[model samples]
Target: MKDDDTRIKFDSEEELIDYYCSKPHPKAFTPSIVIVMLLCSLVGGIIGMELIVKFGLSTNSSIIGALIAVIVGMLPMKFARKFRNIHTQNLVETAISCATFGAGNVLMVCVSIIWVFNKPEMCTGILIGGVIAFVVDITMMYWLFDTPLMGADEAWPIGIATAETILAAAEMGKKAKLLIGGIAGGIIGTWLGLPMDIIGVCGLGNIFALTAFCIGLIMNGYWPTWFGYSLGDYYVPQGVMVGAGMVGLIQAIILIVRKYKGRSKTETPKEELKTADSTFIEPEESELTVEQENELLGEKDEKTGHIYTRTTKQMTQTFVRGIILYIIGAVIMALIGGIAAEMSEGMLVVWVIYAMAAALISEILVGISAMHSGYFPAMATVIIFLVFGIFIGFPPHALAFLAGYTACTGPAFADMGYDLKAGWILRGRGRHVKFELEGRRQQYYAELFGAAVAVVLVFIFYRSYFLAGRIPPVASVYKATIDAGVNGTVLRQILLFAIVGAVLQLISGLKRQIGILFAAGLLITNPIAGVAGLIFLTFRYFIEKKFGDEGRKNLNVVSAGLIAGAALFSFCTNTFKLVSTNSKKG
Candidate 1:
């Protein structure tokens, strides 16, 4: 950790304080970074739309954005020197990462639902609603980050990969060569149609959870051939996800409650806990300053003197605020989509309330899976909520609105976690509290800008894609599920599977999240990915066994390299395809 390039070193306490207090941090929203961010956003948007439409998945573009920043910094120009700052590079990566998810997972999915249902007239309402949901989702993540729940220490594999990629590129040593080699291998493997990203995750993610995920994938992919029953056809995956998601949410609440409830005993004095400022209450005779009080209230890293900025209380309030905001956004979408006109007042109320709840739950489920394994089942989670909406007997148009609005929440939420995790690492793991917070705020602004860009890109280009009959694979599934509706047999299957999923999640507890990862795998039904990931995991285990912690550290760099390489290849090839296809159409 001491040799890690992401850390800041100073000669003495005076130097450290001067570095934190006096240095002018790189501005995220400056004109130069903004220009680079916009360019990266365009590239990210194109890659996202192409990959999602063609293959039904979107890779994190953080590495691509960071690589672009690094490339720009290497140019021989006076102005280019400023781009060398790691903070500036982090902001650029944050922007493109948001744009990628915002375009593909949020806006495009929403628009496609309306188009698939031949309700193009409602596309405007869905887009606006999606945009609003996206903003609120990112805002909530911003507030929730660094809390006890989704702390900076969470795996957040994609973020770690991006951060390592930047660090390696800047340092340019043996680690850099390893990263470059891994990237090249990733590119070559992906070109051969391999799941390089899954392999990358296999090396970095929780082994137990990923093993469960691989088992689920194998079961989902093979059971149809061996037993002649499609898990998806029986709604088995959906049921499992529903059960696991419910338990996962409860587990989160329990953790939050237990943390706060036991705070008086473990954290603060009983008298301090009762004060207006809660844990910040200091002794009268001590006369400690506010900084000292804050340090007392938060967790301090002994080596770096870094105290966490977000409190448990603040996280809870932000979560509640997010719920309220989602409710408002749902109501706005329902009104704008004209769903209110077709439903009874009671049913309309139910629809709005359910949409809000569904969005929040979906985001949590997706966020947890992403934090653990970097695999977010956004579409499947949306479908799970859509199934519930069907049971509630909403009309087809309302279902479309509900599904689209629900889809908008999770991807951006999870992607925001990745960006912040990267920023947290680059900012020296929050060692300098004020500087870290400032960098985080800048990342948020950059995310907002990128999301706004994605909204515009989707708004402008979705019609062309729809006209060309290029819709996401999930859109058709959404329509089919809505049209077929649900039956008693389906309900029974879902309930049975739900129980199994719940038990698995409960047994796994929160940290491992085996159940969530298993559900994510089952939802996809890609046996090849499972097999490939298992192979990579085996390799990683051996490497660690032979070399110990050093091997693990080296593997982290290589895994990051693999992800970056695959992403770069995907971007270049996909961008070319998009351009050529659109040109031919024109």
Candidate 2:
């Protein structure tokens, strides 16, 4: 082997720092990122709770509500001309939004527990738990604040600061201090929230959103300390109220701090400031080459006489196409959900059908976006959820929630595509995006790998003198619902009809709506589901026209973020459960 010194090279300190700053790392600023994610979980929890209480929704509705809130929150940024200009600032904002969503979800869980138990004191316990969680999260964030990984970028500081504010608010016992902390947390949260929002809305599936929610749940004392003491068993209504109150306190403090800090910060040098205003500086003329400018504007090189500019009209056309696809996809999704709900006797089958449909929809959208603009995939996914939710007897608010959540996935998937495209655009290493795609393809296989490894490990442990029989299969909400007998036959029939319709449409070259109608006829036995389908269809018709050109551009990032956040949240939650279970047993 070559000597170890052979691989070593020296560089100037400045050069090394510049190099380090330019590169992204898996673990860099991870703690800050985790904190920001926790905050997002809190927000999600809170939104989930509010939906349940205000709208009298279920878990499904709460999820949908959070999804809707995320989409609504993302809209302003989507339309703003300056949104993309400040990438770092956007990153910070998105992080904050994610944190808020997470916080909301936690609050929702607490409230739900309270409602279930019908105990007033449970609220107090929840409040204490929330405070404790906030303190732990914030303290950990602060402790890791000065690490080089957290200091290398503008986004990191904002994320860290937001977490810090949340900690401060939770720890502050005085009413005034608590008020101040809440205000500060909100402002900072808002500031840091945008990036995550963007990611959640525009990305196809969010890995972060779910992960953050799960982590926050654990940190906030939602995860059961004992296997037999599951979260569902121990959660009380009072605990939820107290948690909400604590959250409110933190939000107030954050807002107050922001208000006071705003005055003094205005006097600082413009260059030194790290607000959204300062971060999104316009790109200089030098940054764009003649070729790049032509590419961006769809202009052509004079000598080559090739037109490179993609007109606003062309972009609009692409947007319209995406919307159309989305509508069609939605119809298909609704039909599937309805059929599954109707046909299967087993609840597990229903969930499996739903997951399969979602996975298929996601994959199809991804493929379609690859062939066109990135927005189509996410739009398609959202439309699918909305159409199905309404058509299959979901409540109006539930439909709205589904629409929002589904819509969010569009952006998440689009982002994955965009990231791939960015690699193409920037001539970066080809492996990053390619690897990502491959990873997605092999995800199921990876689970199998993990299972196999786990089995082997268990066998080894048993043989090595540890007292062990076979590990029991892990129980989950899905399993419980399955046991409850949620049927999927109706949903399956609907999906089959949809497939038939699509096939017919392809063969006869008929309008796509014909396929939707066919699927609807076969699957939608419930009036509620039918109403949802009609509502979404009507909305799609108007909005499709209204969006014209703007929606096309806006849909890409926003939808990507939504999807990414949802997926992230789900994945994280599952991972947490796995970790907790495994850790406990070990």
RMSD per model, one decimal: 5.2, 22.6
What is candidate 1's lDDT per residue for 4-60, written digit by digit as tens?
223344453233333433456778778888899999998888778877887777767
For residues 1-586, write the lDDT of model 2, one tens digit per residue: 1212212122322232223223432221234433332343344333332333333221211222222323333344433222111121222233333223222222233222222332333333332332222222222222211111111111211122222222222222332253343333333433443323222221222122222222223322423443535322222211222222223323423533443455343223223322323222222447556533332332222233322122223323433443344444333433433422333345334433443344334333332222221122233233344334434544332233233223223222222222222212121111222222222222222212222222232223322221232211111221222223323653444354444434432332211122222222222122322333233334434554798665432333233323333334433444455457668979
Candidate 1, position 16, lDDT: 36
TM-score of each: 0.89, 0.24
Q: After superposition, how far is residue 357 of candidate 1 from its true place, in Å?
A: 0.5
Evaluated at residue 130, the lDDT of candidate 1 is: 82
* Stretches of candidate 1 exceeding 4 Å from the true structure: 1-22, 268-296, 299-308, 583-586
| lDDT to native, each model | 0.82, 0.29
What residue pairs clash in candidate 1, if any at all?
A: none
TM for candidate 2 is 0.24
- lDDT of residue 445 for candidate 1: 95
